[model samples]
Target chain A: MPSRAIQENFRFLVLEVTKQIESTVQVVTTGDEALIDSVYLKDDYIDNLRGFIDAKCLTVIRDADEGDERTVELARAVDIVTNNLERMADFAVNILRQYKYVKDHAILRGYGLEPLFAEVLGALGKVSEAIFKADVNEALEICRSEFNLDEMYAERFHRVMSELRAGGEQVEDLVTTLFIVRYLERMGDSLLNIGEAIISLALHERLKIHQYWALEETLDVGRGEAKGLSLESIFETRSGCRIGRVRDHREGAEGNLVLFKEGQRDKLLEERAGILFWQERFPDLVPKILSWHEGEHHASLLLEYLSGQTFQQILLEGTSDELRAALQALGTTLRAIWEATRVDEPVQPGFLGQIAKRLRDVKKVHPGFGDDDQTIGALRVPAFADLLRRAEAIEAELPAPFSTFIHGDFNVDNIIFDPAQDRLHFIDLHRSRRFDYVQDVSVFMVSNFRLPVLETTIRRRLSAVILAVYRFVQTFAQEAGDTTFEARLTLGMVRSFTTSTRFVLDPSFARAMYLRARYLLERLLAHEGGDWSTFSMPTNVLRY
Target chain B: MASDNHEFRHESLEDRTSIAKYLNALSEAFANGNLTFGHNGHAIELEPRGLLKFDVKATRKRGAVKVSIRLNWQEDEEDRDPSVGSLVISTSGEGK
Candidate 1:
């Protein structure tokens, strides 16, 4: 038996311990993607949280020095909380173990947005600084002005994605850009959150308290248009060089910015080397490559320095219909790539092409192969015999077309809309490939309408938009005597035919893609005078 | 870590729920000589000390209890010596 007051104190301590545990866990959970994924890091965070809980519990017990019986009861309560808190830590650690990156460095040479990313990070840093300093006007100005860099980057990104889609470059580059852009966007969101939190805290009149300022901003500028370096030849330095004090202007932009790492310099040099190679192969790709000296490395082609609002930066500022316009611009930009693209290299016995080959082999081995769960599960639609059959049938009707570069990565944020010129500029063309039109279509569709949150109707409308743009682009390619576009389109159509049900039935992104496919097919049928519905795709294809 | 010389006694006071009325009754009883100290050989007072210790020792007994306690004391040098205390009882049944 214990006194009522001692019992009440014991219960109050238990509740406080619980509250502290909850708050600490919340703090530990909030962070970047890497922090959220790893079991080891998550476990460490949980353990740290539990340790705090233990300290709080100990404090409660020590402060409440009641008689022996009451002290004993409180001590027991502390032990109970300690045990349960430890268990919660274990659960958090288990969550992080699933996402591990295997590669030391994946090639990202193709998505050439070094300049754009540099500006993005710079703008983000300035905004964060303004928010930290409580300069609301500066914060708003940075938010408004950050989109100006989009024009340069978006065009570069589009060109790169186009090249990759056309199978002109490696798929590895495309994968890297996907991760890079996703992270960059997320980083932008984090900065916004920090700014909002600061504003909220200030409104409570608790401003300028508990400031621990240590935020890092990094950007890498690669190759041409930014060559030559000297502390003194400062004005001679180019846009890609690190911003710093001016020294001289005799030598071209080379080895100048002392702030930049040697690795960054090497990367820029690599880009220069790559540009030389590109110029040698495709002389007309850039208008008359300029040469400071008569060497391949010395040649420079000056592209228009783009400084306009990006669709993302614009959307962030909340001007309505801007995002849709940006999306449409992205779609149009991809359509342009689809119109002029072809595979520069043969499908080099790679995984995707191999799968297509295997589909052919498997069909030969088992002519009566039925779509059993095992068979369906093992099959990729593009590699299926039926899809290849449709592609072969469609290919015979189109003339052989030359392959032009296509951008493999096409997303809205990579587009820069210049209202003055009424033109959209694309950026990051490192992953420029010479592949089929379908590759471009897939990239565009996945990037544009692959959102997890889109409703069915909107998804359908978006699908329609994609197919319409795809067909329009393919037709243009056809008119230009580029039959590869038609071939690519045929392959894509065959794929759609074989896996229409699977596309439609996907529990996840299916409904969206299905609607888009339906819209595209309907338009395609109307124009081509052949009903895709009458083609009779089997129901077994809906294995997904 | 309080002053070791402070004296404390474990008194077997009556379990009183009604303090005022019961105290008054006890006072009247004491005045009327109905209650007496150590009545019917009952011990009500005890001596207390810091770090209370208890031990048992066996000794030869004559036709009764089989064991007896060997009590010892250690007092602070500046303090008065502590009073030694113990309780002794014999089994009711005779040892064969």
Candidate 2:
């Protein structure tokens, strides 16, 4: 039997899970809308109870006398079991929410989930008993019962998909049912994790849970002829891409290979194509694509790893002289790329169209965005709709500029600079295309200023680099006479700052960027009745 | 009686001119130490007292922005309440 503290918390957790499961069953069986609120409320209570049990278990383990290893193991098992129980409760809530999507569908009312629900409840009860009593045999039985739940989920999933594919009018209903069954399967998986934790406690052996199975699969080096390979995750993005370093066992072949995995296949293919294009044309500046694997469910690419710190790291750690050198190199590299890809024919500028579309997107996400006083502090900034109107008017009066193959996402973090080799390498070329050079320039400058740090010294250093790059680009293009430079740059800044809100999650960061975008819009409106050519860039552009 | 204790009343005014007028009225009431606001059949009355606590907060998230100003005061009692601590004010940059 477990200790008093473990047994007490386990009893509370079991009670909470039982309540959650009952509410979920009520929602599915009775279609009682009021019970849905109870389900969510109970889920919240279960979450709090889980936190309390977790703290109590930690206290038990910490306050245990020396040489009390058995108590520590029991406490750890209780912690793991309670956590899984909480997750199971969450999945129950998810099932209820998904059920709402199909509740009104006529086809779903006759479909029965009673047997599967009964089996899941039985398994949950057995697991709870196993945890509270430290019954290894019962926990093992729960593990065996998971296979049945998986089979039921698969059978139901296939039936739902077949119905969906048959092109019935209730396709939405079928899809929601599919998700509901999937959540039930995931709940079974959570129970299996709890079962494994119990077995580990009884046997006094550490066992790896299923969630770490993917890492274990990746570490399995038996598939290839390459020997002694090590994998380390280096970066992850919101798009679910995981980039890792693959080092070889051989002395010379190590640290030269990078692996990109776990993102959309088409995006990975596009990145591979982009890298190949640049590798062929600008051999010194792009990593060479080694090999690619496009499997049924997973896609990945292997590329040569470039050695150096990113431009962001350089800016943060390098000396002023080093920063200036890096900026000059960046300018020179951009000039080369532009010169090579510049098209003689001028295309109608798409600046206004892009800005208009982004404004609509932001407004769609937040209907009452610009009406709040906190948006621009004390300033009376125009609404996004008004800004779009002014931008349209301004675009009509401006001449079309030349188009070049510009890096669509030319942020500092995407560029790597090897000071030893005096070469710059580019990554994340997914957005590369032919566009206005000012877009790249604006993104680079704004990205630098958007660093979280706001020290005056760092700001001055960054401002110097931005001004130097601006001067270099202007002189290179001989665009001093070009009337559209300042106006286009301002519009680019507006686009950059506004669209950045989609990526930033922190409230203050989002507000600051929104205010900056509004500030640019205010500047643009100030020149509404004046000459567009004579409008100068703001001196405070890079100061922030 | 429990339902009545839990009753809530809310009114929203969006027009700038009308909101300004309402604000002026509220300002006058604060100066007079009593305020009563009502719309349609629902209304609330508040009496101002010594030592009002004021809070101003601004928040932006997921493309939406909000600024809230709240004032609160406690009714005087003969026995001191331990739960009521010293009033504290903290401020940060509007956009930081």
Instruction: Provide TM-scores for the models.
Output: 0.30, 0.52
Best by TM-score: 2
Scored on chain A only, each candidate's TM-score is 0.33, 0.59
State the lDDT at A393 in candidate 1.
36
lDDT of 2 by residue, A15-96 (tens): 7797788778777877777888878878778888899889888898888889888888888988888898899899999988
Summarize candidate 1's per-residue lDDT along A1-544 as a digit string, tens digits. 2234433443443343333333323322332444343435445554554565456556656666566544434344334434443453333333222112313223343344345445444544453234334443344333333344445545656765776788844555455455444443433343334343433222222111111010001111231112122222112233342222221222554422332111134433443454354345444332222221112222122222344566545544424354345445545544444444444443321212333544444334343322321232366333233333333433344433344455433444445676555456554343445544455454544444443434533443444444445544544554565534433453343334323323223343443333333333333333343433234222111111
Which regions in candidate 2 have their CA more than 4 angstroms from the true location? Answer: A1-227, A250-257, A360-382, A397-400, A479-483, A502-512, A525-533, B1-96
Report residue A73 deviation for candidate 2 (angstroms). 15
